[model samples]
Structures are given as structure tokens and as C-alpha cells.
Target: MSAPERIPPRSVTTAELLAKGELKVRGQIREASNAVLYCSVSYEGQDAFCVYKPVAGERPLWDFPDGTLAQREVAAYEVSEATGWGLVPPTVLRDGPYGEGMCQLWIESAADSELLALVDDEEPADGWKAIGFAEVGEGRTALLVHADDARLRRLAVLDAVINNADRKGGHLLPEGQDRLYGIDHGVTFNAENKLRTLLWGWAGEPLTGEAVETLTTLRDGLASGGPLATRLAELITAAEVDATRARVDALLASGKHPEPSGEWPAIPWPPV
Candidate 1:
């Protein structure tokens, strides 16, 4: 089967492509979770941007689908959305010269343009810490800090439920002090073993009234013909999503708050 002829999926959209956009953007290699090469495209009559993980038209060591990572990341974003948590927008996975590939919606570029890796295990040369800053705009000088553990803990629970393996510090974008944006979630919600992350340090801890309320809303709201269903389905498998729903039901039925389980108060590291 001539390797299933490659097809051009939907073109990306950029709000800038409209009569008025911030600036004319050319393809630039910006640093994110991993070294991401990207370009600006018009999306839905808006000046949107897409970041792509380029393949050198060759096979990787894993020898899996060439570009499948991109697709998996898209699924990651879907589950994040279902949680009503602000996360990286969705992208499409297409066939590149070598194998499967991914593309994603771009957030307003940060001043540092660097990632927030706690440690340097799976990153490029300079890493998220070393990348110097460029003034994207006037007031956007400082990098968003993950100083807020409470918020990270909340996100960690969502990551745990979704099984996000790479919820590193760098994947989070600090819009300002209070606002945060999460990205690069390709590794999530798989059928095999779950890679619960650090977002749930407060796990067995009592579920906050707000936390219980949010889980209830998500449980009641998530269904087949829902606004966020398509995105959620894309992020997780049917079995996994159903399992999350079941867990939520059990938690709510028990009327229990959230807390950490086992010896560790949080996920071994932090956040969770």
C-alpha cells in the first residue's frame, strides 16, 4: 500500500492573516518543551500560529510512526480542555516526508521564549533555563514563575487523571502573575501504565469545595454531544475518558475531599 499517499490536512489559521494582525511573521525556530520549528498561518480568520516538530525526513531511534508524536500531543491538549483548564490549543497531525507529524496553535510568544524545565533530561542544548530573552513587547519582560504551588497541585491532579508524563515546569507559560498557560502534552492518557505527574501533591488531602464543585461540573457537563467532547475524545481513549468519569462519580458519591495517597503527601517530586 504505497504507504498511504500523504495528504495535506487543514491549513493552520492565524488571526494576523486578517486585515489587521500584530506583525508579519515568518517561520522561526522558537524554543518550547523541545526545540520546535514553527511558522505563522491564518486560522479561522484570525492571526494564529503553529509550532511543528520537524522530522529530518528520516526515521527516529524509536522507529515508530515518524510523526505520531505530534498527533499524540494533540490528544493531550484535548483532555486538558475537558477539564476546563486553560491549556495549549489543538493542532493536526499530518504525514510529512518521513512519518506522522504534529502542528499546534501558538500562544502569544513569551519574552524569554524559553521553556521551564526543572531538570535537563529531555531538552535541547541551552535548555529552558539558559535561553536569553527578546522583547516581544514592552511590558512582557519578566518570565512567568511557577511560584504558585496550589495551582500546580490542581493541574497535577488533572494530569494524573489524564496520565500526562511530561508535565515539566517548562510546559507551563506564565501569562502574568495569576494567569498560566500549559503546553506540549503529547504523552498522556495511554492504555498501558499511567504516568501520574506532580500536579496532585494534595491528592488524598481534602478536595476543596471549589475542587469538588469543579469535578461535579465536569462530570455533569462531559457527554457525547457536548462542546468539549470532540476535544476530550481526541486527547484520551474512550476507555480512559470513561474511567475518569467513573472516578469522578465515585469521588462525588463518597462526598470526600481530595488528598494524597500512600506515604508521599504529594507525587514524589512536587505539584501532585
Candidate 2:
């Protein structure tokens, strides 16, 4: 006899499904530094695609403590949620076939969205901001630029707060016209100044009024004994949480987009 057809639940949320559903690994994302499993999670037949990064599969980084990348990814999501920007996809820490891991909803990027570009001109055109020059190959150079979009500006602020060490161009997932999502956040929330990103077009510029307001909210939420602080303590070191608070305070005090520290590489290798 044929098996009965499965029926999906009507009220299950993406977060709920990701946190409580059965995870079946479909394949491995071979390009990732750590083991990234492409899986379908189902609860009461409600299924959705997601990326799962198991803690056991995490590679040791000299800068970051071992076996902490998954937690940091979840912590990044928490901070993103507090910003009310939803920049990171719905992510949760849960047990999968490979044990504990971070499960995030898979976002399909719009094929035609162009947020980063390499132009031959010395300066970027209107509506674009230059991120300095890059060596393409064979001693050739091109001007690297990104869109002067509010979404990217907000992301830059978030990256500053989290001390995101890797914000490659490929990490920016443009969803349709109005929305964008960032992925691969396992290297965030470091206690030190390790902000490496491609979104440096607005460096040294004044923060938007909206950004100031959001930072204020973040400051309050990250106060000692506050909910954000408490949640982050569970994921990262206490010192790292304190550093996050300090970064927010610094942004508020400066009231401007942060410039590269010059101590470390401002942009990650292979920007795209």
C-alpha cells in the first residue's frame, strides 16, 4: 500500500519550524570553511530549506575560541532582531543529525540585483559610493563601489556593533528590490576590533537619524542585566558582550560611520 500523503501545519512559523522540526540533510555546501549542510526541516509536514552549520564541524580559528562559531551566529541574529532590521535570516540553535548547530532559513537572492560593482571610472556615478580601488588582475585596477542604499548603511552599523570580521560581497543576499539579507555571520561578535567588510562606502560619514535612534535602543537593550545582555552572555564570552556594549557606546558618541582602524586589513580577501 502507498504511504499517506503528508499535510503541512497552518500555524507554524519559520522560526518555530527551524527550532523544532525534523532536519534531514540534503547535501553539503562544499565551499564553506566549515561544514554547512543544506537541509529541509519539517514539522507537521511544514517543510522549508535551511542552512545548518554544526558546531562539531566548525574549524578552529586562531583568533576566535574553538567551538564557538555557531553560538556567535545565533548571537548575531539576536542583535539583528534587536535592531528591528531583520538583516539576518531567521536563525536558531538546535540539535541536528550532527548535534548542536545553527539553522538559518535559506534566502534565494534576486539574480539581477547589483549592490557591488567594479567600475573603470575614477569616481562612482550618482547613487553609488566608492570603496577605494582594487587590483583586478595583471596589475590592472578598478574602482570598487557599492550602492548608497539605506539597507546597506544599516548593515554597516550592525557590522560595527558585532565586530564582524568577514563581510564579503557574496554575503549580501538581495531579496527582490526592497529587501536584503546578510549571511555567514559565524565570525561576528568578537571582543576585539576585527571589522572587515566590503560596505565601507560611508566611512567617516555622519550616521543617519534613524541609525542614531536604533543605536540608542541597542544601548538600552544591552545594558547590564538587560534582556539582550543576558541572551548574549549565553552565546559569547562575558567580555565579548561587554565589548559589544562598548562598541555601541562608541558609535553613539562618534555619531558617524566608523572608519577602518588601519591596524588590520579593512576589507576581507576576495571581496566578492
lDDT per model vs. reference: 0.50, 0.94
Sliding window of 10 residues with minimal summed lDDT for model 1: 126-135
Q: lDDT per residue, candidate 1, 1-272, as tens digits?
A: 46887886555333223212222235556444344656555434455656656434223424222234555566666556566665555555543323345556666635563323233233223312222222336655433222324455456556655555556655666565444667766555554334534343344556667657776676765666555555556655566656666656666676553444444323222331
| After superposition, candidate 2 runs with Cα above 4 Å error | 1-10
TM-score of every prediction relative to native: 0.56, 0.95
> Which pairs of residues collide in candidate 2?
none
For every model shown, the clashing-pair count is 34, 0
lDDT of 2 at 236: 93
What is the C-alpha lDDT profile of model 2 across 113-142, one tens digit per residue? Answer: 989999999999999999989998999999
